[model samples]
Target: MRQNLNYSYPQIFWVEGRPNLGTSCPSAPPIAPFPPPVPDRRRKPKNHTERRSVGLLVTSLLILLALTGVGLSMFRIFHLEKELAELRESASTERIPPALEKLIGQKEQSMKKEARKAAHLTGNPSQRDLPLEWEPTSGHAFTSGIQYCDHGLVINETGFYFVYSNVLFRGSVCSNQVLTHVVYKKNPTLPGSHVLMEDKGINYCMSQKTWARKSYLGALFKLRKMDSLHVNVSKIALVNFEESKTFFGLFKL
Candidate 1:
């Protein structure tokens, strides 16, 4: 007898007297590889905005600090300027006391009066009279209370006057002789000149070559207005013209 086989259905086979089934089926479609993870675009925008806000905050803080510093400096400058202006205003409005002003005026007047009553004169090298003519030292000679005329100092005020004179005598040969210096005063009431003070130097230097002597006279006397005062030396030729060596002066007490 011939055997029949079927291909469209499952086939069964017997082994050791047990049945086993075999089946043929199409494979499932190949599974696609998992797709790459996508980035979270919303989260990225939020993070960027946060960073920008932080930057802006920092910039604002820095700007505020700068502006504060500038404002403080300007305030300090303005304060200093205001203080300076106040000081200037106070100085401009300040005034000296009246008592101080009066004292200053009195002092000035006293100084002027003192200046007017003093005189200093130097010897004249060309004088030939008994009463020596003196040349008043320009810077050192000043007389407001008296007039200097010819060889005489004419007093214009009456007071106790302190008179002084110095005569320096120098020669190639020492004279052991006496050297005399005198201060004399004359007035309308007196017929002639009266000696106020006299100085005599006897044997002032030893007899030798290049000898020098100085005669000085100083005294205080009551003087009348219009009194004329003069200086005299024993030998006019021996009198030194140097201001320091020979001088005459007077002051009122």
Candidate 2:
């Protein structure tokens, strides 16, 4: 019998029932093994990568804290420097004792008084037959008081005065003359001059080719204002006018 040959049946290419997509569809690209479910490293991380990221974040935070701490320390250092400067300035302006200042002033006044009322003079030979005129401008010689009519040192203020005089009698020939040194005070109220200090050299430098004798007179006396002092020697020719040899001075006490 002749059957209908146009009947349709299902097409079978694989006998194992599962289609091999690589071999069955040769026109398509060979199917990969789904790429083993590849993961996005940017979105998802491994265990060690997560730990590294966490550690990096912790290290960044620590660095930021350290910088902030350094800033605060610098600020505190500047503030303390300013405070220390102020303390030093205040200490420099501290007050001194009042008694110490008074003592300094008193010492200055005493020095001024000594310069004002004192007189130191060296011997000066004069042609006039009066008391010896003194050389005030000689070495180590000064006169704070003025010359009383070119005679002697004039007292400016009344006080206790220590008067002193030295006379050196030197001669080439030894005659043993009486060397007399006399310091006298002449006041305008008094009629004549009064002797304040006196000394005599007798039998001094007796036996020698060159002989020298010295007479010194020194005394402290209560003097008055405007009183003039004068030094007199017995023989002006025998007196040596050297600074150390003959000198006269007076100071108020």
Candidate 2, overall lDDT? 0.81
Model 1 Cα RMSD, 1 decimal: 12.1
| Model 1 spans with C-alpha error above 4 angstroms | 1-103
Error of 1 at 75 (Å): 21
lDDT per residue (tens digit) for residues 1-253 in model 1: 5667656876798655756565444545878999999988767445778899999999999999999999999999999999888878867987446898799999999998877887888766776787888777564555666689868888888888888888888887777667888888888886987988888888776757787877878888888899999887787777778878888888888
Query: CA lDDT of 88 in candidate 1?
Result: 83
Question: Candidate 2, residues 1-253: lDDT per residue as tens digits?
Answer: 9887896655655445765444455455756775477667688645898899999999999999999999999999999999888878867986445897799889989888777778788877654465887788768888764444566888888999898998889888777577788999888998988988888888776576787877888889998988899998888888888888989888888
> lDDT for model 1, on a 0 to 1 scale?
0.81
Error of 1 at 83 (Å): 15
What range of 10 consecutive residues in model 2 has the weakest lDDT sum? 19-28
TM-score for every candidate vs. truth? 0.58, 0.57
